[model samples]
Target: MHDTIFDQLERDGFAVVEEFLRDAECEELVAAGLELTRHLPDAPPTVFSTTEPEQQQLKDKYFMESNDKISYFYEKDALDADGKLQLDPSISLNKVGHALHLLHPIFRCYTYSERVKALCRELRLLEPAVVQSMYIYKNPGIGGEVVPHQDISYLYTEPIPPIGFWIALQDATIQNGCLWIARGSHKSAVHRRMLRSPEDRNKCIYDRPAPVYPESSFTPVPVSKGTCILIHGNVVHRSAPNRSAASRPAYTFHVVERKGNNYSEDNWLQEGENAPFLNIYTTSQMQ
Candidate 1:
C-alpha cells in the first residue's frame, strides 16, 4: 500500500488515487457491467432503485426474487412490460446495481484483489472482509441525487466501522454527479446508526440524531475513470443528480472487521449463508 494514500485518508478522512486501474482494466470492468444487462431478467433478487416512481415499483418484485445471489435494478422507465431493459442502455437505465461482487467472477477479482487487501491492512482493520458491493449508473437526466450520509449509519458495526472503496469506471465530474465529502468529518465522534426497527424490522429509523457538519467543510471530488476513492466509515458524503449529457458509472464495495462487530440482526438486509458479509481475506492470505 502507498503511504501517500494512507496519509491522505488519515488527514482528510478520504483519499483519491488516480489511475489505480489501467486503461485496459477500466475498459474491461465497464464491459463487464454492460454485459450484466443481457442477463437482467434472470439475475438474483437483490435489486434496488432511487426515488423514481416507475423504478421504485420494481424494487418489490426484484427484491423478492432470491436472497442468495446478485440482482439488478434500474431507473423507473428502464424496463418494459416484459421486464427487459432497453437495447440502448445509456438512455434507458439509471443503474444495474446491488450485491454482485461475490456472485460474479469479474467483480470478485477487484473486490478481493491483493491491492485491496494491502490497503485494508494499512487501515489496521482486523479480519477485514467485504460486506457490500454496488455499481452505480449515474445516467444523464434521470439519475437521482444521494443525500448526505455516512456508511456506518447503514452498515452498523460496533467498535469498528466499515470503509468504502469506490472505483470510477467512467469519468466522474461535478456536472455528472461525483461524490462530495465533508473533509475531516471522520475525526468527529458520530456513533449512531440508521437501522431498521427491532419491533417491525421493516421500518427504517436512526438510533440517534444525524451528524451535523458545517456546509463550508464539504468538498467536491471529481475523478477520472480508473481512479479509486477510499472513504472512512464516519466521513459524511453525498452526490448530486446527473444533469449533464454524460454518464458517471462507478463500482463500489465496503470492508469491515469480522470479529468484535455486533452485526445486528435487525439490520434491514439479512439473508444467504454469509448473510451480509463476504470473506475477502484469510489469515496469512488474501482471497
Candidate 2:
C-alpha cells in the first residue's frame, strides 16, 4: 500500500488513499459536523465568485478583515425565531496548530498512518510533522472552483515544502469539483509568478506565470466517501466547482518534516500567535 501510494505521488504529484476511514467513522464525523452547523446563527458568506480577479479580491478582503492567522474555522447557521439555531456547517482549518489533539481518533489515524510516513520519505522529508488541517463544506450550488495554484504559495515557511492530505467526506466526482493535479509538477523548480493579487504578495512564493501541463499528462482524481488525496506542497493543482445535486464536504491537512534537511524558520508563523483555526502549540508539545 505504501509503495503504491508513494509511486503514484512521485509520478503524479498526488495520490489517492481509498477507504481511509471506516463507515462508522465517516458517519460519526458527518453527524458531528452537521450538529455543529445547527448551532450557527447565520449561513457563511459564499467565498467563491465568478472571475479570477473578483475571487482573488474577495479572498484578499477576507484575509485582511480576518485575523492575521491564515488558519481558522468557520461556522454558518440558519437561525429560527428568537435567535435559535436551525441548521449550520461546522468548518475549520489549521488542524495541527488548532485542534489535532482534540480530534477524534479516526481522523488522526488517517493523517498519521504509516502509509503517510512512507510518502514523506519519497518527498525527502524526514521526521514528518503535520502543520494543520482544514474542514470545509460546499452546500448544493454553494461551492466554487478553487483556482489553480500551489499550496506552498499560501503558507509562510522557509523551505516552502510540505505535503497535503485532502480527505473526502462524500463522494468527490468530476461533477462535484473533485481535485485536479498537474502530473509530475512537484519535480520542477517552484513557480513564483501565478499569483493574481498584491495584498499579501510576499505570502506567495511564486510570481511567475502559471505553467501549463498537457491534459494527457494530468488526470482528475476522484475518490469515494472516506478516501483521501495526498499531494505535494509544490504541486500545481485545483478543484472544479461543486455541481453535484448534494452538498460536497472535505478536509485537508498539511504536514512537513520536523528536523529534516532544508529546514528554515524565516516563514514559520510566530509562536503563541493565533493562526486561522489553529490555536498555538510549541513544536515539542505537538510531538
Candidate 3:
C-alpha cells in the first residue's frame, strides 16, 4: 500500500486518515461527553468570548486560576440577551474542555492511546509531549465560525511547531461545518498569534497588520464519525459556522517537541518557567 496519509501531508499540508476510531468507540466517547455536560454549573473557570459579561463572574470564581482551566463555551442560542448562561445541557453547551485528558479518564484513554502514538512515530515525532486537549461541540445553527489561521500561532515552540490531531466524534458534513484547509499552506511561515496582551493582561492581541490569504484557496474536508484528521502546525485552516440542524462534536489535541525542552515559556498557556507540559508517552494517565 502507498503511504497515502503521510504523502498527502508532506505535499498538501493535511491528511484525513479514515477509521482511526471504531464506531463503537466513537459512540462511547459521545455518550461520555454528554454525561460531562451535566456539571456545567460547577465547571472550572473557562476561557471564551471576551464580549460576554459572564467572563467577569468566571474570573471572580476561579480568581487567578481562571485564565488556565477547563472552560465552557455555550451555543449562541444557549444564552439570553444579557449573556447569562442558561441552565440546560442541550442548549447551554458548546464545548466543555481544554485540559480534558487531565480532567477525565475516558478522554485520557483516547488521548494517550497507542494508535495516536504510532501516528506520531509515522510523522517522525521523536519526543512528542501532549500540550493541549479540547472537545469542541459545534452545536446546530450556532456553531461559530473559526477564522482562517495557523495553529502554530496560538501555542508556539522554537525549532519546531506542534501537530494537531482532530477526531470527528460525529459525522462531519458540509452542512455541519466540516473543517476547511488551504492546500500547501503549511509551507508558509506563521504570520501572527492570538496572544494575551502584556499590558492589559485581560485582553488578547492578534499581531497586526494581519497577514491575508486568497479566499478561493480553501477546500472543505468532510469525514465520517470515526475518521481522524492530522493537521500540520503551519497549515492555514478554518471552519464555517454550522447552520444545519445537526451538531458536529470533535475531540482535538495537540503535541509538540519535549526532548529538547524548546516549548516557549512566553506562550500564554504556560503556567510558569518550570511548569511541566504533560508527556504524552509516559504520563501517569497513559500508564
Model number with the top TM-score:
3
Clash numbers, per candidate: 1, 16, 1
Error of 3 at 21 (Å): 0.5
Best candidate (score: lDDT): 3
lDDT by residue (tens digit), candidate 3, 1-287: 77667688888888899999999999888887777677676543333442353434223334223234566666666666766665466545667656676666888899888898788888777788776677887778777677777888877777777889999999999999999999999997878875556785545455654566788999999999999999988899888888999989899988887776476544556543332566666765543
Native-to-model Cα distance after best TM-score fit, residue 58 in candidate 2, in Å: 8.3
| Model 3 CA lDDT for position 151 | 88
**Tens digit of per-residue lDDT, candidate 1, span 148-252:** 788877676667767899999889999999999999888877656655556654555667665555668789999999999999888889888888988888889
lDDT of each: 0.71, 0.55, 0.74
Segments of candidate 1 deviating more than 4 angstroms: 1-4, 42-67, 77-90, 207-215, 274-276, 283-287
Query: By lDDT, is 1 or 2 better?
Result: 1
Ranking by lDDT: 3, 1, 2
Candidate 3 overall lDDT versus native = 0.74
lDDT per residue for candidate 2 within 1-287, as digits (tens), equals 35676677777788878887767766766665555444433433323333344333233444332323322332222233443334433432111122332243444454556555555666666566665655566555545666667777644344547678787888888887788888788888666533323455334233454555556655688789988788877788887766568666776777755563343333323223443222122222222
